[model samples]
Each structure stands twice: as C-alpha cells, then as structure tokens.
Target: MTNLWSPITLGGITLPHRLAMAPMTRSRAKPDGTPGDLAPEYYAQRASLGLLISEGTQPSEDGQGYLATPGIYTDAHVAGWRKVADAVHAADGRLFIQLMHVGRRSHPDNTPHHRQPVAPSAIASGDSMFTMSGMQPVPQPRALETEEVQQTIADLAYAAKRAIDAGADGVEIHGANGYLVHQFLAPDSNHRTDEYGGTMKNRARFAIDVVRAVVDAIGPQKTAIRLSPGVATGGIAEGQDNDDLYRYLAVELGTLGLAYLHILYARNDPLLEDVRRSFGGPLVLNRPGRSRQQIGADVSAGLADIEALGVMALANPDLVQRLKTGAPLNDVRSALFYAGGGAEGYTDYPAIGIV
Candidate 1:
C-alpha cells in the first residue's frame, strides 16, 4: 500500500517520502521583493520533508498581493532565492518556487506601484487586505487589455526561466486561491469575450497558456501548478458549473505531462477522484487542517501520490522523524504567522530536544 512514507519520484527527483512542505505566506521578504536572510535557515531546517515548495513568490511587481512576499523575476530576487535553494539542496531537499499573481486580490497601498490592481475583468473582489496603515478594502481592478494579457503570460514564462537560473529544482504556478489564473477560470470574475473568457474552454485558455509558457521556459519535468476546485477564498464563487469546469481542466492539463499537480482542497469528494483520473500524473493533495492520524490516508488509498502539510510542517522542522518516532508537535503562534520580529515564531520552533 502506498503510504506517506512511501518513496516517490517526482520531477526526476527521488524523495524518501511523500510528505512535502506546502507553500505558506510568511510575508518575510524584503521591501524590494527579495527573500529575507533567514529564509535559507528556515527552509534548511525543514529539509527532511524532502520537497519544500517555497512560499508564494510573485512573478512581477503587479503580481504581489501581500506585503513582503518574494518575487522571482528580478536580479535581487534571483540572488536571494539562490541562497535559499542552495541551503535546501545542501540538506537534500528540493525546492520549487511558487509563482503567484494575485490579480484583483490586492491593495494599492501594498503594491510596489500604488495603483489599482488588474484582473481578467474590471470587477473587484470586495475583499479587505492588510496593509502598512491597516486593513483596507480591495478596490476594483482594471481589466487587462488583450495585449497586456499576452504580456502577462510572457512575464510568467520569464519568471519560470529566472527560477531555474536561481538553481531551484522547479517552479509551481499558483493558479489557485482566487488569483489571476483563478480569476480567469471563474465566470463571475472574468467577463471577457476574447479567447480567454466566456466558455469554460475559453476561461481555461489563460491557465493553459500560462502553463505552456512556463513549461516552454522550463522543461515539463521542472514545471508544476496548484489548483483549488471548490475553494471560495478571495471571494471566488465557482458556482454549480464548478465540477464540469475542473473535469475539463484536469483532462487538458494532463496532456501537458507536468511534473505534478497540487490540489488544495477542504473536503474529499468525487470531484477529487475525477481530477486524479483526468490529471493522470503525480498528484499532491493539501487538505487544510488534516490531523496527524490522517496523514497518509489519501496516499494509502491511492487518491494522491504525495501529501502536503502547512502548519504541521511549519512547527516541526523535523516533521518526518517526529512522526516516525511519534513526537509531540508545537502549537502554532497564529499572531506571528506573517512577517514579524525576526525569527520568534518563524524559525524558533525547537526540533525535538534542545531548549
């Protein structure tokens, strides 16, 4: 039976286990979009997880949604990430930098350019986000002109190439969580009549294009993407057609021979199996709030090839060994989840013994 500890090969890398560290935003990057200095140590500590997907790093300045999130398209960003990649690799961990474009889920005050956000449509998510001043309401975004949409896809490709230059094992496109790709997928968020909107196939065009571009920039083995089907985060409403949309999407993505497809889900449903069958590749499933007992359930059941952990891996740097020996986990300090005083709650969590 395939379990969490089962050896698996993904993207040409043989991992000792199936447990991977999910990308969680820590907002710890520098103001210029470079990763913080402690990023190397933070990731190196979790090297036992084998596959560490870095926190959502933006593809461009306009791609940033949260404060201090890293970017992958610049020299400073590349150098900063190189340090992180070297650290993780030295400890036998493979790194995949997640390229995320936040779309309309951003605030002007938080962006490098203090301008309105952009998306498939000019619609606003009507969500609020944290900024330097305080939490502010998300404003309406300008719709991307057809030309700009093409440019955005090109930008993603460029970022993927840059990720390789930084010595990352691969790049995972953040197509989930009501971001730019998700905005194009949802009809409500995308009102375009062009080749990128309207029908489900059309809405899927942007995502498919982005993936193809990234795959072209980097080889298919060095490229992956994360998707959330039923998630309503960032005011994304997939509506009733959600099931059909994803079936079509999975089948389409499966054709590209991607390294793996990461699915972020809240509950298990037939849709999960549908996607697994249609995707037909290594699937990494991240079920938020999954308990310790349920660690290998999906993998054992053949529903997923790998399992992703967020808070559990965050608190336990030696998560694999701790579980292997049955050790207690540290409680999460929710208040300091984001960028805060240096490494208090970020990397101060003890491995197992030393105090």
Candidate 2:
C-alpha cells in the first residue's frame, strides 16, 4: 500500500507527498485586505505538506465576505502575498491561492466599499455572517446584470494573474462553499432568466466562464478548482439535482485540462465515481469528518489521488513527519480556529518528539 509520504504530481508541479493542506479561513488579514506579517509565518510553519492551498481570498473588492479576509487583486495585496509565497518557496513547499468571490454571502460592514452584495438574483441567503459588529442577518443582495457577469469573470482572470505575479505556484478557483460560483450552481440562489440561469447548462456557464478566463490568463496547468457536491454548508441549498449539475460541470471543465479538481465529498455517494470519471486530471479528495485511522485506507482503495487535510494541518506543522513516524497527533482547539493572533492554537502545537 502507498503511504501518505508517497509523491504525487499535481499538474506540472511535483509534490513530495500526497498530503495537501486544505484551505481554511483564518480571518487574519489586514483591514485593507492585505495579508499581514503573521500570514507568511503561519503558512511557512506548515510547509511540510505536499501542497498548501491558501485560505479563501477575494478576487475583487466586492468579493470580500468576512472582515479581515485576504484579497489578491490589488497591488498591496500582491506585495503582501509575495512575502508569503517567498516564505513558502524558501521551505520548498508548493502553494496555490484559492480565489473566492462570496457573492451574496457578504456584508457591507466586511468590505471597504460598503457595497451591497451581488448574486445571480436579488434573493437573500436567509442566513447571518460574522462581522466587526458581531453576527447579523445577511442582507438581500442585488442581482448581477448580464453584462456585469462577464466583468466578474474578468476580475477572476485578473486576480489569477496577480497571484502568479505574487509568486504562487498556481491558483484554485473557489467554486464551492456557497460562494459566487456555487450560488450560480445552486438553483435556490440562482433565479435569473438570462443565459446565466435556468437549466443546469446555463447555471454552470458562469463558473465555466470564470474557469476558462483564469485558464486563459495562466495556462490550464496552473489553474485548478474546488467543488463540493451535495453538501449544503454555508447557507447553500442545492436540490437533489446537484449530482447531475456536477457531472456536467466536471466534464465541461475537464476539456480545459485543468491542473486538478479538488472535491469535498459529503458521503460515499455513487456520484463520487462519476466525478472521478468526469474530471480527466489529478483528483484531490477531502473526506470531511474522517478520523485519522481512515486516512491511508481511502488512498489505497483508489478513492483519491491525494488527500486534503484541514484541522490536522492546522494543529500539526510537521504532520507528515508525525504520521510517517507513528507519532501522536496534536489536538486542535475549535474555539481558536478563527480567533486570530499567534501561538494560541496557531503555532503552539509541538513537533514530533518535541513533547
């Protein structure tokens, strides 16, 4: 059986291991959307992972969702990210920026422009989000005009270029997590009657266009996408037809020859196999809520080419060494996952044989 330390090639980049550090929102950026000093240190500490997918970063001003979340479109954002990319590269670790456009999942207070959130339709998420003023109901968003949708795709392409200029290994479009792309994919959020709405093909058009634009900006080998099938987290409510939508979306995206497709699987649904067949490149699977004992089994069983980890990578900087040596794993504190600051569940975790 291949162990977790086995090497895997993700597109043109060759990873030293099959373990990828999944993107987790840290909410630690500067107020201006620039990644702070702590950001580089945090990512550099966990550079042992085969690949590090940075936290969800907004691709444009209106894309900002949570307060202090990072951005990649501005010059300041690029400079901030350059430091982070250099730090990770110095450690010989590969990094990819996850481009996230929150769509209706945004708050005016969280963004600098204080602009109303926009989506495929004017409907509200019926959910609340965390802001500087604490939890509040998500306000109704304005619907994007047909022409504005094209500009949004252009914004993503520009951001991908900026990320590459900032020294990232690649860019991963955040098409999941109930963000802008997911909102279009889910029938509940997308209520438009234009070319971007209605049937599965139309609904998937916006996401495909964004992907194509990003791929065109920085070749397909440097582009990737993250998708969640049938899991309705973060106020996203897609009906049973999610399987069909993903099957068609995946096949369409596969034609572009993207670097990889990262799927956050909810269950052992038969569609998982369909997605694997639909995507014609490297596949990275994140088995949410899986225990440590089940890690190696999933890969050995041919379920995924690479395994993505979240809290484990958060708590254990040397997770690869610990797992390979059969050492005890660090216990993660859920409370401090987004509390921000240093050494309090961020870098306090000890390395293998240290404790």
Candidate 3:
C-alpha cells in the first residue's frame, strides 16, 4: 500500500517521499530574464520538499509571455539558474526546471522582443496580462511558419541542455495549461493546415515533438512532461475528441520512456485510467483546490505514484515537516502570490515554531 510518505524513484533521482512542489510563477526574475538574486533563498527555503519543479522558464525570446519570468536561453540565464540549482542541492533537494513556451499568451510589453506573440495560428487568446505598464489584452499572435515551429522545438532542446549545465537534475516540459503546448492541443487555437493541425495526431504533433526533442537533448530518464486534459483556459477549448487526443498522446509519447507524466487533474473523466495504463511509467498527479485531508488519496489508490502541491507548498516552506507532524499550515497571501522581486509573501512565510 503505497502512500504519500512512501519513497519513489523518478528520473535520475529518488525522492524520500511522494510529495513534489508544483511549479508556480513567482515573477521575481530580473527583467533581463535571469533568475533574481533572491531566487536561491526562495528555492532553498523549500528544499525539504525533496523534489521542486521550478516555475515556468521560457526557452527563447519568443517563448516568453510574462513580466520578469525567467528564461534559459543565455549564459546569464544559465549562471542565474546555477545559483538556484546549487542552493537547492546544498539543501538536499533535487531541482527540475520546467521549460514553458507561452505562445500567444503574451503581451509585447512583457517580453524583450515586443514582437507580436507567435502561435500555431493567428489568434488572440482573449486573456488579459498584467504587463509592466498595466493590465492589457493579449494581441493576436503571428502564426508561426512551419520553420518557426520547428525552431521552437529546437529551442526547448537547447534550453534543456542549458538547464543541465546549470546543475538541474532534470527538466519538465510544460505541456499543460493554456500555454504553447496546450495551444497546439486545442482545436480552435491550432487552425494551421500544416503537419501540426486538423486530425488528433496532427494536433498532438507539437507536444510530442517538444517532448522527443527534450528527451534527445537530455535523456529519457531526465525528461518529464505535464499535461492537463480537458482543461480550458486562456481562451482554449478542447472541443470534441478531447479524450481521444489525450489517449493518442499517452500511447504515442509513452514510447519515449519519459521520466514521468504529470497530469493536472481538473476533471473526473475516466480517461485518466487509460492514460495511467498507457503512460506505464511514473505518474505525478496535481489536483487543484484539493484539501490537505485528500492529499494522498490518489497515491494510496495507485492512481498516481506522486502528488504535486502548489499553494499548499508555496505557503508552507516547511511543508514536509508540517505535514509529517500535523502542524497548522500558513495562510497564503493571495495578493502577493505574484508580486515580483519582493520577499514579503515570497520568502516571509514562517515555518513551524518560527516567529
């Protein structure tokens, strides 16, 4: 009977427990896309969680979508991340940088290029972003030429290698959320008649290519992907054949022998069972708004090998200790969750017995 307290092996590292800190954007990176000076302390403080997947890191200038979000395509970015990896390692934790390409979820003011956002199609996500100036609507993105799409995949592979050079144990591809990969997954967002659209296989092409390229750059044992089936956000609609698409992805991408497949469990659809069987490897499940009492339910039932915590871990840096001893958790300051370059809600959360 495996439980959250049980140890599990994932990728190139073995966790002391099944609890992993899910990636949450802190918006504390330098404007130049380097991890901030306080990044090391922020991550090191939460190292007791064993496995910490970093916030979304763009792989290229065009991949960025948020203000002050980190990027991994430069030597400066590598150096900044090296501090993070070294700090987390010194604190006895393994770091996995999640490579995220926001695609059309971008505002020109938020990124360096100020180039129109690029995506599988020329469509605006209809989502608002809080840029440096103020909140603004995401503009219609430029449809990537087939060559540009290929370049995005190559950029992800290069970033993965850079993350490794920065001392990260592994890298996780951000295939979930209404970001780049999800843009390609959803029918409405990916209207191109190229090899990446129309049929389910074609629509899944970008996600698979990103994963395969990452695996090639690093190793199968060091590559992981996160997916959210039936998740509609940032103006994405999965439409019909949602389950069929995911099933195809599970079976197809499974052949690469990825380190793990993290599913953001937003629905109770039975497709998860098929996904579990198809992936046939380590599965990490993240359930939004899940209570503390329900933490290990999936793992105990064998539906997931690990559980990922977002705000719960964010509000409690000593999350592991508090859970083990049944200590009261810290309340999350929702307003400051995304406050860039501040230590108030970012690193000021008190641990157990600390004033």
Candidate 4:
C-alpha cells in the first residue's frame, strides 16, 4: 500500500511525497495587489511539502475579489512573487501560483479602481464580504460583454507567463470555490447566449480556453487546474446535471495533456469517479477538512495520486515530519486563520521535539 510519504510523479514534476499544500487565501498581500514582505518567509517555512500552491491571486484588476489578495499581471507583482519563489526554491520546495478571477464576488472598497464586478450575467450573489471598514454587501455585478470574455482568458494566460518569469514551478487555474471560472460553469450565474455560455460545452469553454492559453504560454507540463464539483460555495450553485458537466469538462481537458487535475471532494458525487476515469493524467484529490487519521487512506487506496491539505498544512509546518514520527499535532485557532502579522498562528507552530 502506498503511504502518504510515497513518491509520486505529477505531470513533469516528481514530488518527494504525495502530501501537497493546498492553495489558501491568506489576505496578507499589499493593498496594491502585490505580495508583501513577510510572504516569502511565510511560504519558505512550509516548503517541506511536496508541492505548494500559492493563495488565490487575481489575474487582472477586474479579477480582484477579496481585500488584500495578491495579483500577478504587473511587473511589481512579478517582482514580489519572485521573492516568494526564490525563498521556496532555496528551501527546496516547488511552488505554483494559483490564477483566480473573481467574477461577481467583489467589493468596491477592496479594489483600487472601484470597478463594478462583471460576470456572464447581471446577477448578485446576495452575499457580504470583508472590507477595510467592515463587512459590506456584495454589489450586483455588471454583465460582461461578449467581446471582453476572450480578454479575460488572455489575462489569465499572461499571468501564467508572469508566474513562470517570477520563478514559479507552474500555474494553477482557480476554477473552483465560486470564482469567475466556476461562475461560468454554473448555470445559475451564466445565462449568456454567446459562445462562452448556455450549454455544458459552452460553459466549459472559458475554463478550457484559459487552460489552453496558459499551457501555450507555459508548457502543458507546468500548467494545472483545480475544480470543485459538488460545491455550492459563495452563492454559486451547481445544478443536478453536475455529473454530466464535469464529465464533459474532464474528457475535454484530458486531451490537453496538461498538468494534474486537483479536485476538491464535496460529496460522494459520481462526478468525482467520472473525473478520475475521464482525466488521463495525474489526479490530486482534496478531502475537505480531513483529519490526520485519514491522511494515508486515499493514496493507499489509489484514489488519488496526490492528497491536498489545507488547515493541517497551515497549523503544522512540519506536518510531514509529525505524520512520519507520530508527533503531537498543533491545534489551529480559527480566529487567527486570516489575522495579519507574524508568529501568532502563522509560524508559531512548534516542530515535533521542540514543543
């Protein structure tokens, strides 16, 4: 049986272990949409993982959703990310930047231009988001013009190139978590009659195009994608036909010969099994909120080539070591998950023998 520490070959990269640190929004970037000074230190500390997918970073100005999130289009953003990449590399860890475009989930206070959020249709999430002032209701986003849709895909491709230039191992398209790509995939959000919307194939087109473009920008081996099949997060709902939707997406994307497909399991939906069957390359499965006891089961069962972890990676920097030696695990503080600063909950987790 394959253990969590077993080696796995994902795309062109050979990982030392099947344990991958999942992409998480830290909200620690500069207000100008660039990674901050401590960002390097933060990632460097957790570089022991087989792979590190960075936080949800906007591909363009319009893609900015949450306050203090990072961006990758600008030279300054590239420079900021370069530091992070160098730090991770110095620690012998592989890093990939997650390119996210938040369609309708934006707050005016969070962005510099105060631009109205845009989506496939003029839909409002009816949700609230955190701002500098406090929590505020998310505004109704403007409908995207058909012509502008291609530009957004182009922006993602451009960001992928910038990520490689910044020394990242690759880039992952953030197509999950009710973001722009997921919004397009969900019928409730996308009602357009254009080529970019309306059927499962059309709805999947935008994401596929972004992937192709990114792969073209950076080799297919370095480009990856993340998807959440059964999730209805952030007011985006996947209808009853989710199985058909993902099956179509997986088959089409599999032909691209890109990097691994990372799936966040929401339920025992047959779509996950379909995706595993349809996708031809490596598949990384993320069991949301997984406990330490269940860490090795998925890999051992051959259900996933790699296992992605969230809070466990955040709370335990030496998680690999702890799991190997049965060391005491750190208790994560939910309150400090997004709190800014050093060593509070960020890097204060002691190693196995230190505590």
List the RMSD of every prediction in angstroms. Answer: 0.9, 1.3, 0.9, 1.2
Per-candidate total of colliding backbone pairs: 0, 0, 0, 0
lDDT of 1 at 88: 96
Deviation (Å) of 248 in candidate 1? 1.0
lDDT for each residue of candidate 2 in 235-332, tens digit (9 for 90 to 100): 77665666799999989999999989999987845788888888878888988787888877767877788899999999999988888888889888
lDDT value, residue 94 of candidate 4? 91
Model 3 misplaced stretches (Cα beyond 4 Å): none
- After superposition, candidate 2 runs with Cα above 4 Å error: 1-3
Prediction 2 global C-alpha lDDT: 0.89
Off by over 4 Å in 1: none
**Pairing residues by index, what is the TM-score of model 2?**
0.97
Clashing pairs in 3: none
| Poorest stretch of ten by lDDT in candidate 2 | 233-242
Better of 3 and 4 by TM-score: 3
What are the clashing pairs of model 2? Answer: none
Candidate with the larger lDDT of 2 and 3? 3
